[model samples]
Target: MHAIALTDGLPILDARSLVDVDLPQPQPGPHDVLVEVRAASVNPVDVKQRAASPTLRSPRVLGFDGAGVVRAVGDGVTLFAPGDEVWWAGQLDRQGSDADLQLVDERIIGAKPLSLGFAQAAALPLTTITAWESLFDKLALTDVSHGALLVMGATGGVGSILLQLVRELLPGVRTVATASSDDKREWVRSLGAAATANHHGDLVGDVLSAEPEGVDWIFSAHSAGRAADFARVLKPFGAVVSIDSARELDLDALKPKSLSWHWEYMFTRPVQRTPDMVKQHELLDAVAGLVDSGRVTSTVQTVLHGWDAATFREAHWLVETGRTVGKVVVER
Candidate 1:
């Protein structure tokens, strides 16, 4: 198998940091499926990993989200078989989906959406699962009919799909999407946001201006450096959800109002081998149906080809720019 691997754990640049390596084919475990990589997407997680220098004895493979065909399945796998089209955002503890073949747990895999090609379907799983868990599972937004949600970083992948889910799943809920510029704001609107806020400006004020009452929920896909500010604007009993890196967050600010803080890590279930790990399969299945029915769509902004190290590096550079309108995908 040909893979883009971290040859050395040094400061990683784009192409210079990643190297193509040949490795023996990986076999599936008792509950795993071996996927022949077809299409993959770059994520902020990739950039974060590349920016660091982790000591490793072997070249580390590093891609998180992918869509491909199942070449083989383990003895315990029953949800899929060889020749099945599947997509999944794999666990963080193992080799990722960035090569000719990768092994993933079938419990976290879902049938690809019939309406989309490999590249398009690859862009949704990771972001969709993250946003879905954040909104519904973590934030307790089971019924937000009369509520409002302020989404930080609304022009990005998870934010884009999240806004659409808010529209389709909670039609009556008001959405205030946060973007950095006018064009990005317009892009957010296209995804069904009810209003827009400038994260670069007075975020809380902008959201407040859109809705007189404080927002009922905050789905932050970016830094919540102003956690206190957001806390101040959230309705007393409202909650906040985030998936970004931890910082010196003033969690005490949320204590006064009895507000809560929730974190959503899409990899938690798979990494920890949670009993309900199959929930990822169910969520992906639901989203795939929505995609096929035209209720939801992919957020792939930039597309590349050649499934090689050079191409992966270029895609990473685009994502690191932090201004990409949506997800960036690369296909073989």
Candidate 2:
């Protein structure tokens, strides 16, 4: 099988940061499925891992989001068969989907949406999982009847899907989004945002101008530093959920309003091998159902060809630039 891997963590500019290599085709474990990867997508995790993680004794595969057909399944894998098409964000600690073939736990896999192609399907899993878990699981904001919901960095991968899901799942809930560009503002509006603000300017004022009373929920899909700004716009006793990590946060700012802060890391379940790992599969299934029902749409913005290191690096660069409006995919 052909694979793109990193023998050492280095700057992506270095040609050796990622290399193309040939390895034996991976076989599935008792509860695993060997997928013939048809397409893959890059996330900030890939860029961070490549730049910061130390060199590994073994060359590390570096992609997480993928969609493909099942080539084989382990003896205990009954959920899917050899010919089934599936999409999943593989476990963070394991070899990823940046190869011709990849192995993933059956419990974390889901049937791909019937309406989308491999590249389109590949763009959803990682971002959708993050957004779904952040909003519904960790923050527990399934019922939005109380007030409006604010989505920061609303034009990014997670934000795009998150916006649509909020609209579908929380009907009649007022939704606000922040997008710096005119195009992005229009995009979020199409996704059902009640209002759109500029993240580049005063986010607090921007959101407040739209909803003078303040919002009920804040989902920061961008930086945690934006949490302070989000806190200002949040109604009393409202909650804030963030997927990004920040070095410094003024927790005191949220105290006066009695605001609660929660951080979500979608990979935590798979990284820790948690007891509820199967929930990821269930969540993906729900997302697929939404897509099938036309309630949700793929966030894939740019699709590149080939699964080579060069292509992967280009995708990484686009994401790292912080300007990509949606997910960038790579097809085989």
Candidate 3:
């Protein structure tokens, strides 16, 4: 099997950061499926891992989002067969999808949407899981009746699908998405945002302008320096769900408003092998239906055409730029 791997935790500009190598084909575990990876997408996790500490004893493949075909399945795998097409986010502890073949647990994998190509399907799994978990599992958006939802950093992969999900599923709740520019605001608006705010400007003012009162829920994609803004813009007893890391958050700021903050990490279920791990598969299947029905769409912004080191380096470079509208995929 051919694979592109990171030799050490180095910058993407380094020539040895990502390199092509040949490895033995991986075999399936008792509950795993061996997938022939057709396409893969790069995410922030990949970039972070590639540049993180602890240089590896050997190269580690670093892709998380993949759409592929099952070439073989273990005896315990009931959800898919050898010929089934599948999509999934590979577990962090395992070798990733940046290879010709990968072994993934069937519990977290779903049937790829029939309406989409491999590249399109590959662009969704990781972001879709994050967005779905952030809204339904963390914030409990479905239970809220009539309130405003703020989607901070609304031009990224998760925000792209999240806006559509809220619009299609929660009809009563309006959304205010944040973008830094005119074109980005328009892009998020096209994805179903009721209103758009510029993240570079006064975020609280922008959101409050759209909703006279404070918002009921906040989905923080990039939450590093916005803790004070979150405290100010959320209504009393409102909740916030974040997916990023923050070094300095003033917890005292939330006391006055009785604001609750929650962190969402999509890899928890698979990493812990939780009893409800299969929920990821179920939600992904449901999202696939949404895609097939045209309620949701793929967030692939740039599809780089190749399966080599240079291609992946370019993908990482684009993602590291932090200006991409949605996802960047690598297809064969």
Clashing pairs in 2: none
Task: Put the candidates in TM-score order, highest first.
Answer: 3, 1, 2
Model 3 has an lDDT value of 0.92
lDDT of 1 by residue, 69-151 (tens): 99999999999999999999998889877789999999899999999999999999999999999878998676535788999
What TM-score does candidate 1 get on C-alpha atoms?
0.97
lDDT string for model 2 (202-257, tens) is 88888899999999888886655665776688888998888876777767788889
TM values, all candidates: 0.97, 0.96, 0.98
Task: Specify the highest-TM-score model's number.
Answer: 3
Residue 233, model 3: Cα distance from true site in angstroms: 0.7
| Models ranked on lDDT | 3, 2, 1
Residue range 1-332, candidate 3, lDDT tens digits: 99999888778989888999999998888999999999999999999888884677887988999999999999898999988999999899899999999999998999999999999999999999999999899988774467999998799999998999998888888999999988898889998899988888888788889988889999988888788888888999999999988888777888898899999999999999999999999999999999999999999989999999999999999999999999999999
In model 1, which regions exceed 4 Å deviation?
10-14
User: Which model, 1 or 3, shows the larger lDDT?
Assistant: 3
Worst 10 residues of 1 by lDDT: 7-16
State model 2's lDDT: 0.88
